[model samples]
Target: MSQPEFDTYATSPRTLTVEDLQVSVGDHLVAVNGVSFQIRRGEAVGLVGESGSGKTLTCRAVLGLLPETGEVDAGTITLGEGATAVDLTGAARPTWDRVRGARIGAVFQDPGSYLNPSISVGRQLVEQLRVRGGLGRTEARERAVELFGEVGLHDPAGVFHHYPHQLSGGMLQRVLIAIAVACDPELLIADEATTALDAVIQAEILELIARLRRDHELSLLLVTHDLAVVAETCDRILVMYGGEIVESGPTEQVLTDPRHPYTRALLSVATIGDWSRRTLEVIPGQPPAAGAQMPGCRFAPRCRYAAQACLGGQVPLTEIGTGRSARCVRLDELVTDASPIPDRIEASA
Candidate 1:
């Protein structure tokens, strides 16, 4: 059978809807609870939070690469299908195998680890094209060169012959990106792909991804903790905490007029300027342990404005404005109150 025309569906301007996503590591411990959002074709959505906040796990679930311990307890992930739709959750691996790399591609953090150290970069790239994408070896090599050039790698032929260890960090990352986009996947998931690079290289990598997205009219799910990165790259942002979405909205709205205390705290700490006179502040207290269970709001323990409402039960994600939602009880009051907000706490490594 011919490859499904996913691009046509992608370009039809449909929404990628996720609802009531709950994932568990084992029988009792939940890693992602009630996570939901939408990514429209040709738009960028960012998932932001500290490490262990389930950002990575959520993306992994979508990619069908969840750890062996992880299980999807409940959720619905719908991808547009040319006037139809594909329900991603509960779909078998065989079904996902067709979509994973062809229609959706992922750029993971740590390019060094993602790429095989012993294999030539060209060989790895071509191998993926042949096995996963169903291209012949000769066709794959031809496409691989084009991909290398597309990602701004100089001397595609020379780099093709080099092993992963022979390339610099930035070059290796670019090569990995080339592999991910080889098939022109409709959705691209970038999980902190630029974190390990230096600032200058980081900027270059981000720009490259943005350029590729624009050029291909691709939808993006960018996962990162850096608010600055979100500000620069994302059209919409979702703030996650303790495995749930705490705040979500247009990037500008959430950053400028934050609703949740946790979202505000994250923004206050992520602001990059004034570092000389002020120490970097972080949210007070560590995130709850994965195995631990809580009765009320998970963020209530660290939230300065937490009240009886927070301690009573789980706060549903409430719509505070058009296309904006947050899981906090006193959201309006918290925005207006002039209580001294603490500086970002320095999180431990």
Candidate 2:
């Protein structure tokens, strides 16, 4: 039988397209390498990797909210398409002011990091609604109450008046979520949105996000290090390593049938650790730091199947199948079993 065609996902109305995005810190560190991906309307794509893999920086680059000293060095960062497509690459502050909260909203990892402790949650939400949504104070407050209810906050009016510090982490996160969607942005970049909450609260937050996506038809770019979270929340997965996209595909295929050694190594930790009565499974070796001069596949140093060719030079991305891609030199011979991971690659944790 002929091999199944890999380019299976048909085109849709894309909300955001990030092409060849490069991010740097000052003039030294290249935090995000040439990363490219698109989030179509109503789709949820997860960016997963170890910390420092450039997931957060990529998200920051899209909204022009990079931290001090961080900047997008090259490539196109466009929102929408065709005549309406806004090229955000090095866009001015005025353009960012209009596009950020209005066109592309975000919910970051920590609510306190974004929320003002001095201001009431209701006031903040109202400000966003009024400024971004162009509503009157009364209308914005009313809508804030509605959003509070929409995010599953029981005491909408009461919660609105309370300050960020008064509420629990989960509650404050809900408030942030409400602000993120106040303008009904086409794309919501949720970077580690559930990281600060407890397990039960995390589940609740994830469920709320899922419900919002289904009801409001919101597209999401969720960035996290947790594989399980991505499996449950995302439709597609992009695996990042050493500041580059190493593999990408449908979540089900990528999680259950990964073609990259790095991906398989990640899955092995989850599956084998759960089943094993013996040693735990983990991928050893640290990812290359940002700005490191990598002459070959960055993952080659840790990969169990790396050959001499894998270390000689840059590895181009290989289309594996069914909208999947990986940057492995031995893509055809890779395995995704939950058997014992090699001792050399077992993480120490």
Candidate 3:
């Protein structure tokens, strides 16, 4: 049978296109299965999911950071503008090397892992400026200091001179952001970039990224598990379950009225309010193993309203409302009789 055309969901005229991307570990384990999304110029897209839901793996594939054990089994990852797109799935390492930190920047989950322990933060930032931004040593130094200030690091000069270990988690995260945005990349991928910080710090980091995107007209792809963060920052949100996107729509619409069971389950956990009289709802089982191959919807096993049809064949993403889509067999039932999640899950942390 022929595959369905994806142009129907190509809502953006962006330089980045992830078309049916599939990443697997060895021959049997698939971390990401047939994921498709687009990142347009000057827009922010959020990929939200529970742990092991392929959010990070999807972003890593785009950045060419998939482990050596992993491979892009199917699909195309196109970058840049025009009708002609760069096919990055099985491309040479040098091709992605040229674009990774230059044209496309990435802010990883932990800043310390990315930073060299021996080098002073200033030197690291300067090196990125020199290599990625193509600036002279003196010019790079100036830019590094300016970037430090931009990311809200205190005593920019002093922090620059200190090593990564000397800086706090929040400070290191700022430095990572500085390095990622050094060259003013056209696209930025932040993978749980603020997960380690406190609430106040996370807010600041989110605001910083938002401001940077607006001021520089940058396209952002944020991978996170926080629904609140997506609501606050992203223009469009994709909800991933198992290894594929289960639902996607404008952030506000998706949050306000989710059409997928998995999405509703996720929002149920993330949203906090009064929980005194209600029981918290949690998705019963863990995500299926990456090694486990299955037909139909991977989420069917855990879905409360799943039918035999859900396991009979592949489920297609169907549009439920304007600019909204969900991959479900009983999408109409799920939407019409979507149960009300409790006002509060657990008390706000």
Candidate 4:
């Protein structure tokens, strides 16, 4: 059969659009609630928050890798835009097989665990290329080698035959990246992809991801707790707290002038900017546990500027500015308050 006129899904400008996603664990515990965001073609968006902030869960829901006990309770995860848009809320295995790797790719923190210890890494890559890329054995091997080289692995032919254990952590990660993009997936999800690496390696990997995104015009969804990482790599940022997006906007805008109190708190503690050493601050209270019952604003208990009204009822993620939203009822008052939102904790006397 002749090739179709065009691939609408691959050409769609909006690579991923998640709307009001709700993921529940067991029956009562909602791990991710009312979360929403979108990533345009070639856009790099960061999903950031402390651990248990539903960052990973939201990504998992999109990738269809949620645990058996966990289920997408509500909302829709739309992949692509217009005629090719697919609702991935409860997509079947075949749909996932078509999307994952081919349309969407992912890289997680641990690289070793994802690779088969007994098999040669190149063989694995070749297999994926044959299956996902629809290439013959010889073509798949050639493409796998090219991908390894594309990911900056030296001696691509030599590395191809080496087992996963033979490669260093960074090398293994590169192998994973090579496999992830072998099929030229439209979206790449990096869930703490560089967290386990040392400072130098981390920087290298981040630069690699950035370069790959630029070269391939791939939409990137980077998940991490490190604000500094996102600031360097992502175009836009979505700050999550208590299973919801507390703030979303351009990375520079969100980092510099955060509107949400939680975002502010995170900034106060984030190690960014100058190299000069300074006492690190910390947010006062622990984050709310997943599915924890909170009638009003989830961050009210920990917010320094919180008032009675904050805890009175449900506080919406109010759009406060152009492309900025904050889940704080006191945003108006806090903005006009003479005293700014002070640093959470200062140096001890």
Q: Best candidate, lDDT-wise?
A: 4
Q: Write the per-residue lDDT of candidate 3 for residues 1-349, one digit (tens) a residue.
A: 1111233325546858898988998765988888998877777888999998989888878888888888888988988768546677777988877787788888888999999999999999999989878899999998899999998998898888999999888899999999999988889999999888999999999999988987988889999987878878888889998889999988877877888878877876775333363666788888998858787888877776667777878798888876689998776555444466434322112
Higher-ranked by TM-score: 1 or 4: 4
Please give, for residues 1-349, the per-residue lDDT of candidate 1 as tens digits: 1112223333446547788898899766988998988787778888998889999989988887888889888998877656657788978988888777877888877888988888899999998799788899899999898889889899998899999888888998899888888888888999999888899999999999989887998889999999888888887889999999999988877877788888888977876444464666778899987757888889888977776677777888998766789998776655434555544323222
Clashes by residue pair, model 1: 281-344, 281-345, 282-344, 282-345
Q: Find the number of clashing residue pairs for candidate 2.
A: 2
| lDDT of the structure predicted as candidate 3 | 0.82
Give the per-residue lDDT of model 4 (tens digit) for 62-125.
9999988889989999888889788787999999989999999999999999999999999999
Compute each candidate's TM-score over C-alphas. Answer: 0.90, 0.92, 0.90, 0.92
Which candidate number maximizes TM-score? 4
**Model 2: per-residue lDDT, tens digit, 22-60?**
999867699888899888877888999998899998998
* RMSD in angstroms between candidate 1 and the native structure over all alpha carbons: 6.2
TM-score of 2: 0.92
Which 10-residue window of candidate 1 scores lowest in summed lDDT?
A: 1-10
C-alpha root-mean-square deviation, each candidate: 6.2, 4.5, 6.5, 6.3
